[model samples]
Target: MRRHTLSTAVTLCFAASLAAAASAPSEARPASPPASQTARQQARVPVLVDCFFHPEVRPTDFVLACGDGNSRLTSLHWSRWGQASAKAVGVNIVNDCKPYCAAGRFHSYPVVVRLDRAQPWKKRPHLQHYSRMTLEYPAGRPDTFPPTVTYPLWN
Candidate 1:
């Protein structure tokens, strides 16, 4: 009986310590790429994000033209979910057509964004950190106006 009680207490303490260690804080800045980006980029390189809600499928194959900003870029290329590692996707998607749009199972946004400054956001202008573009499908079918994939990045 005494051995059983000691074993139980030890197990509980070990589990609690593991949980706390997992939650320790880490530095926010530095390169931050979504797992999918490299895989997809190898198959189909990122070209450009010309405009938001562009009427037609605007190809992003021109992103190289966008130039690397002063800060080193950390690309995030993921689908609606990041759990499954990014594999090359079907379709040569042009995000310019719908940069901020939610349409059939897929929603897209521009991570390389610029913020207007001199006020609320900052005293100076800034680029948004490596961000997300969502592509969701319900039961393997596209979700119209797919809800934004939720991720929290702290600075």
Candidate 2:
């Protein structure tokens, strides 16, 4: 009789445990992502130009936030980067160095940005850098002192 009662109690407890488990919520599973999202993840990543002050994050048509409020590089498209030269087209913004740099008018000039001896950036090994930036302004530039400008990589 004791054995029968013990067996009945065990069976009842086991059944109650299963019922509680069945009533509980199941664990969540992650849903599959959309096809478009997967395609975009596989697409080629764009490269960005190093503007003066701001850190380069991603490729952009305009070179932005150089910290110089009046001047910026824009419409930049880097075509090729060979050992000798890297070709690009953009517009250069030159602020007139007036009584003070702060109170100066800004001007935009069409330019071709060329990079020679392109190499990997020191700080960011993955990113590319040029030994120098040769800006060729086809249109007339503003009448500022030291009109011709070249940006050096190491400096």
Candidate 3:
């Protein structure tokens, strides 16, 4: 009879503790924004960025290598052409850096490119070429580069 009473008391205590725990509230935390909401806030066009001229390939041509293989300027349509200066609307292939940077898919964004005035090449004066290049981005550009980017001849 004593053992049965002791066991009943212990069981009652355990049940009370469980009830107390169940009634208690959990810790509160701030909820983060939804994926679509975040995407909407950052919804802007990508830019034509990281442009340079590899002299070995050709001085007249410029390469837009923006880390990801897809973010590049493949073609340029010149509106004005001159020995000293030139202007063109560049057709660039930009990529959303999703999944991973190296394997991202491509998107198109048109940008204006200008080679304003020729300067003598530091090593080769015979090649009187434009050393200063500017890129005009419409909607967005790299945080590191300005809208009007003046790129060097051999960057």
Model 2 Cα lDDT, one tens digit per residue, 36-57: 7633532322223454322232
Best by TM-score: 2
lDDT of residue 14 for candidate 2: 42
lDDT against true structure, model 2:
0.54
List clash counts for every candidate, in order: 10, 0, 0
| lDDT tens readout by residue for model 1, 4-98 | 55545554564465455446454533444564764344233222222221111122222211221111112333332212222213222221213
lDDT of each: 0.27, 0.54, 0.50
Residue ranges of candidate 2 with Cα displaced over 4 Å: 1-67, 82-84, 145-148
The Cα error of candidate 2 at residue 101, in Å, is: 2.1
**What TM-score does structure 1 among the candidates reach?**
0.18
Candidate 2: which pairs clash? none
Model 3 Cα shift for residue 90 (angstroms): 2.2
Find the number of clashing residue pairs for candidate 1.
10
Model 2 worst lDDT run, 10 consecutive residues? 51-60
* Pairs of colliding residues, candidate 3: none
